[model samples]
Target: MARINVSQLKQACVDRGWLDRWLDDPATPVPMPMTPAGGIPVNGRLFHQLVAGLVQKLCVPDASAPLLALRSREQIWALLWDELAAAKVQALVRSQSAEAALHLAEALKAWCQRLAELRANCPNFKSWRSALLTHEFDLKRVAIQVSDGGVVEVSGRPDSVQVDPVHGIVVVDYKLSRGSNGTLDLLQLAIYARMLRLAKPGLNFAGLLEYYEPGLHLVPKTEAQLNAIFEHEVQPVLDRIAGHEKLMSKLKSVQVGHEAVRLSWQPKAEPDLGRDIEKAYNSFKVPVQVMGRVEAPQLVRYLIRPGLGISFAKLRSNAVNLKIQLGLHAEPLVMPGSGHVIFDVVKEKPDTVWWQDEVQRAELTAHASPLALALGVDINNRLILADLCDSNTAHALIGGSSGSGKSELLKSLVATLVKRNRPETLQLTLIDPKLLTFGGIVENAYLTGPILRDIEESLACLHLAVEDMERRYEILLAENHTRLGDRIAQGKTDLPFRVIIFDEFADLINSGREEKKEFERLTKRLSAKGRAAGVHLIIATQRPDKDVVTGQLKANLPMKICLRVTNAVNSQILLDEPGAEHLLGRGDFLSQTGSTPVRGQSLFIPQKEFLELFADKI
Candidate 1:
């Protein structure tokens, strides 16, 4: 195999956009822009400039240098390792002729295999060793950011976001290190939190800086901290640029200093093994138990790492025919109750636990109509169950991917309600932002108003519903009634509730705080007091983020309808958790009112069925 090429490494850097925003000066052997800043550059000043350039490009607009100073020890080491590894790989690939370069790749591949073996055999050192003499913290590297010159823009990504459902907004930065540097890190957190609020809608943001290593420190965002970062950290960096230009001009320095820029490399030093293991943690932090099922621990280490990406090509090849196998997939009889089969394939042992399967084989088929189960209006009208509505409340959540029959389910429910309840005793208020889900329900002649859409209109609908609720509350107070049920029992005239339904709630919240605040207020009010006022809400969405429908909203809507959510996580988010993800689409749903969920496919009424059903009326 041929030796690696230095020129080609530089070419790789250029092609990959790695050198795009660097602060490299040829006159200085070491580039100041490439080196990490310690307030002012030390060591290789020229290399420091390149590092500064990287910060400028990656940092969010209006970032404070001081606040951006604290980087996680693990991230810092990983960044450096990636840089070194990339340089090594590119050099090896471009050596000699094209054929020779291919041969060199083979050798490099073998070297990585050896490294993998060494890694596997190494003993793991826990970050925390003992109580008194803890060994968790490691000081890795410092992170800095700089402007990405052009039209000013917000530039940065939050690694993770922790939402404070109770107190508006707070941005938390998880870091390592403490004392004076920790103070600087808090300032950085302040700058980021402020920028985040300015960039998005909602309440002004707060900040939290948490350091995991050494000891814990809680840094709350304060105006003074941000000011310190701006005045001390940001201003000094700007001054450096001018200082460098003036000094360079006076000295007439036309060439970079190679010796001045060279890295502090010990001639025969081995790698820093501790930092390497932490850096090898490629996946998100997961508990050891769940880690086995969701992304096996071995896969994360060997399959996805940048250094080991090429090793995966041989993984599938290692799975050739085996003698004896473990687990259900390897069973001789391809069924759950086949029992243990010998490797000889001639003898089988009876597994008596299989009898339990036979008993439940057909009993657990989820055999019931969703509507019949939801309203407790079984075939004979016997009270097989009691619904949330019957217990003097109504609430629901509907989720479906586009064309997954979410709207169809809504229409069917409305039709069922019309058939079961009276127009005079029950009123429906439909809010369809898309203006199509309630197309079939418009002719029912029981709707309180036209479909609620525009923000102002939706808010007004909420206001009107609140007014109706308050009026009922006043009437109840006058009669000394505890609930609408009590008032109706006393022969009240306006005892019918105003059932308000919101469709495409995700889009409504998409406008931000204005709508979200209104919804939050309306939800809190209705959840706490609307049941007495005969005002209940049924909201539906296509997405299942906790931020949208919200945890508070989901909690109040105990009687929920989950229609083919993308996954089990979402199903769990809406309900307790699991069954929704497994829901067969097209109106197949899981409705939970009290405890156990009822799973069944709703009747699919075609257009002809609806047309014939309403043939005499519409």
Candidate 2:
């Protein structure tokens, strides 16, 4: 509570005739109400925290909330005045309509949002009220005139009493909810204006009401509004103190206006994987830019599933000529009427080498932390996978069967990376064809993606990425960047080392067999040209069949890792040898990178630990 001297407030009221008139009027004895500051029933330090939190969040000066310093615990009018706001919130949570209570919780969230707005929009001042620094209304200067011709002291802390630029009074109060009832209403603003005017004689002041729920509303004070305030609002609070209908009405409004409250429950739609997938595929648009002459690059729309498409464009600008010189071959946009033929390779037919380079050169460098826990591993024996560059190599590959630690490894890896870097520095571009491991991490700031639950969108992303690679290569060459680092040094800051990680690559590969020709062409191109162009790939699968693990793919990817396999044959197919079959089945694995297969333990870090690591950074 900000200790405001009660006697001083009484003196101000008496000096200004505010208290004198109240005592003189036999009908209007001022009821001793609780102070606005330190009005919370809470005690000790917890109460202090509550008051400080209010100062931090709500006291912004924008023609409203003009108090330079306001500290109090009283919650006479249920506006979530303090931690006490939680009681009503908790009650709502326990109600049959618990969801509605959750809506009211947004009050706190709104405060936070308001604070953020103040910080971002306003200059850094010592205090929020510094913006419209106003003079205080000395309530203690007024003395109440008793009907018996005697003086009585009046005491009550106004929410905020400030004179506007014109020396007019302005009083502000925040509300969690409001009601339309003629009595005990949000029109309570009128009363504030009237009283302040009464205390200050010829001064003009407006009543300000800042509402949180049922949305924001401001009923400004006019002369008529002021007259109504004194006659209706002020008199009611003073005379009918026992009823407190207005305050109680506000509490009811908060509950009635609760957004979380739902009338009845309805079953959520069952997932239609096939239909959703069709919509995704249909939404794919691959726009081939023939000097924008194609008229349509591709018309892409929202999709229920992830998918792919193709587009093509020509090289007239400096960027295009740049990529052609840097060993990058443009993909053929083969839609007949689409008219997006790119390279002017008239004499020589576009060879498979182009695809070969494109796919094999895809060096997916992922920042990673190895899985420390497996079927039998405990906390003490958790393994640590190596970390990748926050900006560049935060991507990796997994080749193993069902028994492999593919998902487990991914979890550990994600947890570690998040711990190491903030959302701005480290990002997770996930392509989970299995759609399970990273589903939980589909939060506001972490994912760079389609969430990959949709198959067609995933394919579309691949298409876009392929086209983007072509675009980047062109841009890189134009900027004289033979590589991404070179590009950055020369002020070409647009490009980021995109690590395209596809989990359960087996499913992705198998599902796209109908588009096998395109897959082969795209993968080959990704492998051949992607690494230098800053586009990397992490293709994983439980199945290591010949068709799924094509010969072209194995040749291009230089780094590889594997976990336990079901059989020696599966191990051989995945690792090109037999060590994977010997893996201990958890964090234990045979990781092959730079030509040598090393047996090591993965680092085990819990998700909570991981978040705690970079929580401050974000």
Candidate 3:
């Protein structure tokens, strides 16, 4: 079925011809050329990314200095320009041509200058900062499925959402265009306001279009106007698109047994995968026979028995060549053994490992380990369990890029942890700097305390954990117990296994050098000695860089769980390898117990279901 973007809806509202043209030639690009900056044409996408990053950073400043009103123009601009040097943003800027960087830098300055002018005319920066909620937020949170055809996601991020004293909730969209008279601009703002209203009902939303001009042009649309826009303008377009998509689907559907048929499951394996593998090996002068393949949720493992006289090293060296020859998106995992070479290929339609099903079938016995976590299912569809009590799996370092299912994996891990053990046997310390991931299960009985949100609170939580660890050690020493597990095994249920799951660990470290140092010190001490004291750290970050996941931290965290990363370098930072870069996002993961990395699909539970599951304390 065809997906409809909010932008398309906006264009359709303005002129249905635009939507028809887009549907006819979806691949056609719009003809608006970005203005030249620094002798180079500005990349619209990159410019938006830079602006979005700055807006988000500005809106959600550090908790220590939450007031944007206090900062001078110099400080604000410094923050905006300094953000370019950030690892994630820097990667984006560096990937382009050197001239692209100059273009973005100049474009950013121009954009920020306009922004400053708008802010300067505002009545109160303090009020504005206080009213600000979020920026560059994902619109998928409020995506609505259109007649089972496709999900309609508001494709663009709304500039800002602020609660006004008199105007109520204002959904703000900043415009760089010379005029806000354009139909699409007004519709875009109206659609975003509608999305926010849908996501959070009962909140009155007003669409405010702010243009980048010398004078303030805060055009506010009332709730009645918003409703009119959605019902009169947006709803009609959506209905037409739905009808069109249905027709398209009917035209595409295959008939079988007097009914249009839909396949229950489609295999992701390339029809000529085995043949391609053989062809690749043959090209490298090492002919191999396809033995068989083991199909799993996320990937397929191909068993290739090479012909005699083909050395394992020779075959290993041609891994890259195999990837190229096979036309693979990522470098396929090629393991050349004594007799057979294993080729693991990712699938197009990766299966989901549902949370309830996995937990119901999981082997959660007290005799196994004090902190047994059902990580995910391996290639053989077998439940892969890791005992935090074991030295090799004591601590874990999880890394991934955005939309890589890193957050979902964390939630699954949390659910598994809580489900596997009783509240007395396990306690959780969840620190989410973004204040998003662990909110659903904040009231879970297994939580040691409330979910830590800010850096100060998180640092304090870690400090307290360290102190508690020392006290536990003292108790262990007095009782002549080597480890907490031994004590717990002896029916000492009072000593629960404390698991400190820190999500967005990069945010805390990246806040400042002092904060980073303190975090490192606390985590280092906990990771090194926390195991014996029944304390374990599971630190996760989207930005897996050397600065965030340092060498010392990596050494302590032997068990690495890596999801899809942006590059080989990021994958290497987490797993000391490059395979993670090729992973299919949304729960496709590689878990390294010690040195051997096992690929698996993580169990997923949607936010609503997760919240319901842990709604009443456990």
Candidate 4:
């Protein structure tokens, strides 16, 4: 049973080239690349070695050992400090810079201080010491064969492994970092336990990771637990490595050409290389430029059998140049060549559901509820519907920059509601200060009144909405109903759900101090108390600043829909997250009803289609 070091397994997993190089010639020794000169200086390696050495020394049975014979915690710390100082001087000599040496010295001292603190403060230190003193564990380096096929070398002896009286073989590995335990480290411990089981059969094993920083951190796992993790987590990795090795073994030749590079493989090999090609292309965005009488470089040919090979060289030079111009590290590029036969590839376009499209009309009219407002189709082409009633989206705050499809989203919302519900079931009051946004739908039967174009009229409409909300509350109280939905359910009233939409809410809020105060007051009132009374607000603003979208207003409007904002600050103001800034605009938006935000592409409806949808009514 050949054993590999745990560090070697980790390195193999991270670097594909490591496995490829090793598999090519098992006997060929490959020296691991060191970090480039002048990289961020770190003494982590020195400290790790020092700690491992100390643990090994302390594990010795001899009572006269210097580390074990230390009387006080200070003496143990002082001894460890001396070892660190010696290692630090060696590192400093290699570094050759006084500044680098100082930084290394300071880092080592901090680590030593932290170790001392852990030894003094941690309650588990005594148990750990007792286990190390009592147990006779295997030396650090061990090897085990993966179930898939290959044998991996895992280095590092467990700090201590005890054949416990009741809990079986307990293996402990010391971690000298200052954070939560990492998964890889725990997996390494599990591997150690696995190796121990194979080496000594009929012994149950348990793995523990002892983190000795900030405080003593202990993670204990039984043999069954470790085995489960190895099967679920480590097995898949080994399988992938085997698959990759097989694929690389079949590679016959790689021809690097001026226009394109071609890859030829052995007979009967079909490697999934599309992902690797796509990853290289995505590193830098380059335009496809065609040479004289030739079409642009595209995925020209792909052969799946008789050893699959792909030829791509068309735009390789162009992509490389673009990467250079952008000051980015260039990845190897392979594109279609000029001599390759060009196929007329028809790229599948996104399905455009226009406002007047019969399909959209059917969707809206099919089991439509006044509470559910359909936003748009998501990236998956599923209709993104938000329930104003159940989702606490009774009042929504929307923010987006110009050309972010803010107006289109508002139009879609209005058109969807109108198409779904009768005028008696839904009513809309639109305030478009810019006048151009909601003018097309002004004549819709769902409109409670004409679109308010002036700021003064918008303010007046908000005041009227407050009055309406107060009236509805009064009616609900008088009728002995808690909510408008309850009243309608009991056949108490036929009051329709009123949705007041304000396009460019910033206009009203930034008009004047007096107007801002009044507008804020009315908006806060409606957003807070209007949900139960069947009144809702959908406010859109291009400017999502602290001044415009105030804390008071934001707190009241729980449902936030943010399109592509100018910066992360605006995104935070809108969705309380830093993602809206990264939105690919012209319909992309992040809608947050609760904590998590859902990204969706708003439905695009051209003005022509919008007018055609309402041609009869208008």
What C-alpha RMSD separates each model from the true structure? 27.2, 30.9, 27.2, 16.4
lDDT (0-100) at residue 185 of candidate 2? 33
161-212, model 1: which lDDT tens digit per residue?
A: 3333332245555443343324345445544554555555574656656443
Give all TM-scores, in the order shown.
Answer: 0.38, 0.35, 0.54, 0.46
**Ranking of candidates on TM-score, top first:** 3, 4, 1, 2
> Model 4 over residues 1-618: C-alpha lDDT tens digits?
333355545443333234333444444343333334455444445655665565566655554555544545557557766755566656576766665555555544454453454345444444335534333345454445554465544455555665443454577665545322266576777776777777668877887665654345567787888898776545544544444344444432434355552211111222333333334434544222222221111111221111123223334344444334433332222222213312111111223444444234323344224566667643233445565653246788999998778998898887777666666678889888877687766477677888888888888888888999999999989988877876765654468888998899888788899998998899889888888888998999999999999998888887788987898799988876565775556776767753345556577667876666566654
How far out, in Å, is residue 379 in model 4? 2.1
Model 1 earns a TM-score of: 0.38
Highest-scoring model, lDDT: 3
Residue runs of model 1 more than 4 Å from their true location after superposition: 1-386, 390-393, 489-491, 607-618
**Residue-wise lDDT of candidate 3 within 240-314, one digit each (tens)?**
566555555665583545664422233454454887888878987898899987887878888888788776667
Candidate 2 per-residue C-alpha lDDT over 1-618 given as tens digits, one digit per residue, 9 for 90 to 100? 011134222221222122222222334333322223333221122322443455544444442343322322222112344445576556656662454554455545554444344333444444655432332334552343322233333343445543333323456555554522223333344544554565778877666555656244544455566665454323322322212223334445665554663211122332222333233223343222223211100111111211234322212222233333322233111111112222221111111111111111101112121111111111112122222321112234566666455676666555544533345433456877556655545343555654675557666777877898799889877867666645644554456555566787666566766655566577667766776576666667777667776767666564456776666576666567654654444444555432224443343444455445435542
| Model 2 per-residue lDDT at 147 | 24
TM-score of 3: 0.54
- The candidate maximizing TM-score is 3
Candidate 2: which stretches are off by over 4 Å? 1-396, 415-427, 489-493, 610-618
TM-score: model 2 vs. ground truth:
0.35
lDDT of each: 0.43, 0.43, 0.72, 0.60
Q: Candidate 3: how large is its RMSD? A: 27.2
Misplaced by over 4 Å in model 4 are 1-351, 356-368, 442-444, 489-494, 612-618
